[model samples]
Each structure stands twice: as structure tokens, then as C-alpha cells.
Target: MASTTAFIDVPESPDRIWQLIGGFGSLPDWLPYIPESELSEGGRVRRLTNQDGGVIVERLQAFDHTARSYSYAIEQAPFPVTGYLSTLSVHPVPGQTAAARVEWSGSFTPVGVSDADAEELFHGIYTDGLAALLKTAQGWRG
Candidate 1:
């Protein structure tokens, strides 16, 4: 399996960051590429609509609200990977009461692609997503 992890430190508390992104179906709230999300299967599955109108279906695999972390697996998507499992988490930055670290990590088997290429793709996605999240959080009043 191939894996990639991307993280960003934002000027926000861990609790605030978690409140923004801890939900299983909250991608649209922080990730601009995902403009819409629909939850099904009693909120265990999420159908996301990308900016290009592509549909991506994912199932929540695990969640730990106390830890401010959640994991999900892709059920259907246009990416050239399978068995995709990803986790998003918020962590407190030691000695930084107004700062937090947000991590996006994933592992998957490449399909019709090299492992390097797959990693690059996901790393870019995670990087861009975190940047957007930072922007959104910066604009948030609470």
C-alpha cells in the first residue's frame, strides 16, 4: 500500500478546529473542492460532489470525538486507487493555546498508476485542502 500524510498548523484551538471538521460529512465546510455532501446509511456514508460535479462515495470507518479524529474509506471515486482509507484529525499544539495541528493522511493501493504518482496526487489534495481549511478558520469569528 502507498501512503501520504499532510499537515498544517493553524492559529486556532484544537477544539475549534475539531468543531469545524470533525464531522464525518463536513468536508464541504472546509474543503472547497467538495462543494456538497449528502449523508446516508444513518450518517455512516457520505456522497460528495466535487467542484467538477464528480461524485465520490465514502463510508465512515472509525471516529473518536474525544481525540478529534475520524477515518473513512472510499467506496466510489474517480481516483486511480483502491482500498482507500483516510483519516483527518486535529491535535493541540503544545504550549500554543491558540494553535492546532490538522492532519490528513491516507493509504491505498494504486490502480493503473505508480505508487509515487498516487502519493503525489493525495499529498497535493491534502495540502490544498488544509490550506483551504486554514483560510476558512481564519475567517471564522468563533
Candidate 2:
């Protein structure tokens, strides 16, 4: 039941930013955390090669374009965790001129003897990823 969330303000339309992050196959292009990602529904696995050369393979649980969100579980992650799910959403910020809100969150269960540290780990994971993504997208907006 652990969870974490992050927000990013991008100076662009929500759809424009979504067009970049929603591609589902361009994570490695901007986010250093994911060296590569192969996206699909239900069984498509996300293969992430971390900066430390560690590999994590997550199973795609759900992806809904209308809701502008996706979820995945750690099928065989290098981390000491299980039952993981990461999700993201985009929204227009009220009263913010040409600004949008990017919300990212996730959680996971501890594996075996490791303390349930998935939520703690994902806090930085999602936050940092969004920062990089917004930075990359905003550069193109101008």
C-alpha cells in the first residue's frame, strides 16, 4: 500500500507534452534511467537498464490513453521488491498560463527479507524522471 508522487510544471500544452511522454517507446531518448523500453499492452515488458548497469524487467499491467495513464508491475526487477506498479497522469494547471501538471506515482511490495523500500526508491525514480522529461520537453516548446 506504499505510494509516492511528483509534479512537474511544463510551459506547454498538456497534449503537446503528452505527445512526447505518451509515445511509450521513447523513454531512453530522454530519461537516463531507462536505457531502453519496449512498450505493449498486457504482456509487453519494460526493460530498463539502470545507470549502474542493472537490468529490471517490468510487465505492462494497463495503459489507458483516454485516462492518460499507464501501470506496470515488477515481473523480474533487480530491486528487492515485488508487486510494483508505476503510473503517470497529465492535467492542465488552473490559473497557470500555458502550464501543465505532470503527476507520477508508484508503489511496490518488498521481496523476501528486504524492508519494503519500493515506495522510497520510486519517490526519486518518478520525481527525477519527470524533471528530466519536463526539462527536455520545455526546451522544445520555446
Candidate 3:
């Protein structure tokens, strides 16, 4: 399995960052490719309006507030892939740092793609996606 990790530093508290990333349904606001996303746990699901004007679904595998981390997988990711496990985490930097950085890492098995190509695709997806999201998210003061 190949994996990619990307991080974004936001000028906000961990709580604020968590409030955003934790709300899986709001991912489309920053994550470009995913125009819409939803999170379901227990019996409720929060849906986000997708970038495609449609919708994307997600299932929360695990969420731990106190630990500042969560894991999820796309129900219908619009990609040539399967078994995608995505995880995000937030935490305070060193001392007196009022900023929070969001980092994510995940990997999946290629469906009709070669391992080398899949690896390269995912690498670009994760890094570029994270950078863009970080920029957009930081600009969002609301």
C-alpha cells in the first residue's frame, strides 16, 4: 500500500480547526475535488453540497475529540479507486502557538491503474489538495 501525507497550517486554534475538519459535511468548502461530502455515525448523516452540484457520501470510521483525530472513508469517491481510508488530525504546535495545522494521510488499492501510476496520482492529489485547502480554509475567517 502507498500512502501520502499533507499538512496545512491555519491561523486558528485547534478547536476552530477541529470545528471545521470535524464537520466532515463541510469539506467541500475547502477541498476542491470534493464538492460535497457527508458524515454518518450512529444514525445521523450530515451532507455537504458537492462541488459538482451533486453530493458525495462518507462514513465515519472513528472520531475522537480528546485525541484530536478522526478517520473516514468515502462511500462513493469519484475516482478510480477503492478502499480509501482517510484520516485527519489537529493539534497545537509548540509553546504559545496560536495556530493549528491540519494533516491528513491515506492510501488505497488501485482498481484499473498500475501501482506506480496510482502512487504518483495519490501523491499529487494529497499534496496539492492539502495546500489548496489550507489556503482556502485560512482565507475563511468565518
Candidate achieving the largest lDDT: 1
Report the lDDT tens digits of candidate 3 across residue range 1-142.
Answer: 5567777677778887787767556666667777755555652354545556765466777889887888877667566678878788887865647788778888778789876777777778777776876677668765
Model 3 pairs whose backbones collide: 35-50, 35-51, 36-50
* Per-prediction TM-score to the true structure, in the order listed: 0.97, 0.82, 0.75
True-vs-predicted CA distance for residue 14, candidate 3, Å: 1.5
Q: Which digits, one per residue and each the tens of the lDDT, describe model 2 over residues 1-142?
A: 5667888888887777777776556578768777767655533776777777787777767777776667767777666666777877777889976777888877766666444466667777888888898778867857
lDDT (Cα, 0-100) at 100 in candidate 1:
96
Off by over 4 Å in 3: 38-50, 53-55, 140-142
* Segments of candidate 2 deviating more than 4 angstroms: 39-43, 112-117
**lDDT by residue for model 1 over 1-142, one digit each (tens)?**
9999999999989998999999888889989999999999999999999999999999999999999999999999999999999999999988898999999999999999999999999999999999999999988865
RMSD of each: 1.2, 2.6, 3.0
Worst 10 residues of 3 by lDDT: 42-51
| Global lDDT scores for all candidate models | 0.95, 0.73, 0.71
Ranking, TM-score, top scorer first: 1, 2, 3
| Count of backbone collisions in candidate 2 | 0
